[model samples]
Target: MRSPLRTLVPLALWLLCLPALAQDYVPSRDAWSHASPSEAGFDPARLAAAVDWARANGEQAPADLRDALMASFGPREPDYRILGPVGTRGPANGMILRGGRIVAEWGDTARPEMTFSVAKSTLSVVAGLAYDDGLLPEPDQRVSMQVSGPWFEGAHNGAITWTHLLHQTSDWSGALWDIHDWADRPDGDDPANRVLHAPGTHYKYNDVRVNLLALALLELQREPAPQVFKRRVMDPIGASSTWRWEGYENSWITLDGLRMQSVSGGGHFGGGMVINTRDLARLGLLMQRDGEWNGQRLLSSDWIARALVPSRVKSDYGYLWWLNTGRTAIPAAPERAFWAAGFGGNHVYIDREHDLVIVTRWTPDLAGVVTRVLEALEQP
Candidate 1:
């Protein structure tokens, strides 16, 4: 007959080791779990300085933002444009999470706003989900085999692989969502209508090509990309319901008799991810956790590892995510840290080494903000 306290102790230890019980912080569906900087191993005074710095460097759309863009680019790519004048911007705001607990936030972190190129990272994850589901054969598999006749039927486009598309090295030339690949950000002095490099050998950040990848994903999933992300990624990770990914005005495509709009990769021509900073922080947290939330694995750590591996062509870029190889992307941040960066200073940064996640929207000084924020942590 064991002592009553001894028997109870074993049961208590078992409960403590369970995954859900092991978690120190997990949010309710509608709200985040909060923690003080000191509680989360951050220097309270230094964290305050970081928050104050954000207040002084928040983002606002310039009255001449469009005028400046049009002036610089000569003319708008009408087909790629999202239609109408720009919407009023939300405040320059963000949230910081340490060990999945909210450490601090500034601005209106709940208000949704355009997140530009960060949408590309969202697209990258969707691609991961498809690959995980076996809908895609492999990174090297030719997309032509999956997509039917028309765009990918020709030799130049048919040569493109899923890896090529993910790396932005496909150099797949095409007019998608009505904008020609060569015309989106045409090289002024050396414009090449035809793709000069073979597929997988060159890199180009063409929004049209990104849209093409979206279409390909939509086809591969046999459903909308949003549906896949919602069912597989967001719902499990406890992300907010206020997020939306938008496509261009004319990006609709008919697949299997159902018409679907292909979402844009960025807010460049307009119409991309519109998400609040809190939700953005949630996403960063998930990635920081290697696509796990609480006890469940939303994505395999293997996929996350492969996705962050630098492309052969672009050392500073991973699958739609910006890597800090050689500390080029963020000089102050660790080389292992990576970010999903967007125009207007929108960003979702992940640093597993420091167990930190950061989301910044409408921020102006990315490098300056990152440098100051990283200073709050007790260095390893």
Candidate 2:
């Protein structure tokens, strides 16, 4: 039998959170409600200063993202070249949301730009949706059990579970889309000969491994991952139709006699999410509300909690999301805060304690941005 106290504890917390949830403003498709800085309990002058700082601190990458990609990663990885679509980036822009309404915005918030590794966080949501739909029952189950393929056939690879892949600790060695796992941020001079660690025992940020996750998800979903994402999450959240998720030229495969692209998890080889700041803010807001939107639960709260839990090997990382644990990643933010960060400085920060969602684009100083935003909040 379950303890009475255990049952009542959750009930009590839900009751306490009810009023706050009721007070939140949900935006419509046509327009987002706005609140002045003073109305949102922020210091107006300080908030203005934060926006100015963000505008002045845009990342130094060239506007031509193809050039930027070559300049940033070409020298580090062998045979580095883009195999997917690339686009010219826009200038710095972002928005600050408090209580689910816009409090401040700057620059071209409507421009859709490539969001690199931030797509990883969105991919995590896609995985969670699969888990909720009963397609994926256990996160700790071996990948080989769900789908039979050469990717997970080896001794080390076969041992990997969904949890390991989600945490970026699988260290699954292989090449997908002709890109070797060792070629991504490899060690020393010879990347191809890099040593491999046991599954779930090491943490390495590799796009090849991430793309493998996408492929695995594609196989399980039996349709394009982006289609699932659009139908399930984005549509329910009222996200604009402008956002697009792309995969590489070679990433397409026939599934169930249907040809569909397996979307890349980041823009390392070029394709990921191309979205505006507002749509990004909507994603952050969904996370801030624990996967609920306008009283409808698009994603399970349990999944959100699980996704935000720090991985054993990396405290600052949780299911592809970046955490502010130990105040290391964002010193000025609350400890419970977490975010989706991409290459080229895009971010979608979720601060539940403050009922805040902050989205930044092409801004390198994430820590400074958080500090300035927090400093602008009115003191009790």
Candidate 3:
């Protein structure tokens, strides 16, 4: 017969296990909580303030332009919702301007949020600043000369130039799409890393290739990439927001580690930047002005020209920037346009012909948000 103590102990263990099996189930609100306009950084009052300023300063839009701007926020006969489709639905936010004035703006301008691959286009501005400052070598200089490490040991690897990296034509073989698979391999730096389909042969979008550009910048400056970015680009543009470049660490692991690593700024899209919409608009405006702001030349006009011009890979892609017009499945307006597009619906649309800019943000979705927004702009 079992001792009384043993019988009691088993009974206690069973009681404890019951609670473990019946633990309360609480659903996660991470994504759902973000759907609110306040959470996304929107305040109707702030928009009113901007409108008031525009009115007082003679910067307001005409009635027709205002109607066009409002139509962009919803799906109508012409599909004019400005926010597009957001949060697996449609675009969450949008902005519109004409003649260098804020015609229509919406969503949270104060929310610091993720802009996805759009950050890549912004990175080009940082590189431009470095070039203008003489901190970085000419685009034609070989990577081997700029960086010192085992990675640059071979002739071909060493011969890879900044221009090659910018154009996504670097002879590096690893695909940006496959970075996660290769990142954790025991031999991350194997010779296979240098494999490529002939340099400049094709246009393949790769995050590691872009990250290497960041690494190259780090090697040149001996400082963190974010620091260089702030000093060179953010501060000059008067972007008052907190942003950080994502990276690996022990204490905290990102929800999507691999996806984060592939981005130009190492992922953590929100951490990569948390700027208000207005600041983003200002940056777009500065680019529209050819890298000059407030009469100060932030970057050489020549550099801006190079960035806006299409590359060999596709008519749509320029050094990190996305050219809107030319040859693409997306319909192009007669006016040449370029954009900085992020995952989700984050966008900085620049129209050179009309001197206009449209900025927007939205939750993650792969729908034809880009095409829709462009169509909205084409409205008479």
Best by TM-score: 2
- The backbone clash count of each candidate, in order, is 0, 0, 17
Model 2, global lDDT: 0.88
lDDT per residue (tens digit) for residues 1-380 in model 2: 98979966764564355343334568887789888888777899999999999999997458999999999899989899898899988889999988788999998888889999999999999999999998889989999999777999978999999989999999998889999898888788787887888887789998888889889999998978889999998888889999999999999998788889999999999999999999999888988888888889989988888998999999999999999999888878888899999998899999876778999999977888989989998841
| Candidate 1, position 121, lDDT | 97
Better of 2 and 3 by lDDT: 2
- Prediction 3 TM-score vs. true: 0.63
lDDT of 1 at 223: 84
What is the model-wide C-alpha lDDT for candidate 1? 0.78
Model 3, C-alpha of 197: deviation from truth (Å): 1.6
RMSD of each: 7.1, 3.4, 24.4
Q: List model 1 lDDT by residue over 1-380, tens digit each.
A: 86979956764564344332124466767776777887666688998998888877875746344543455454644333443224447667888877688889887888877777899999999998987888885888899888775778677788888888899998877667667788777765545445368887888888778888898998888888878888898888777888888787787778889898778888777678887887788788889878878778888787788899999999988889989999986888888899898877888989866667888877757777778778886633
Residues 237-289 of candidate 3 have per-residue lDDT tens digits of 66665544453221121232321231244232122444556667777877876
Ranking by TM-score: 2, 1, 3
In candidate 3, what residue range of length 10 has the lowest lDDT sum?
25-34
Best by lDDT: 2
Q: How would the candidate models be sorted by lDDT, starting from the highest? A: 2, 1, 3
lDDT (Cα, 0-100) at 198 in candidate 3: 55
Better by lDDT, candidate 3 or 1:
1
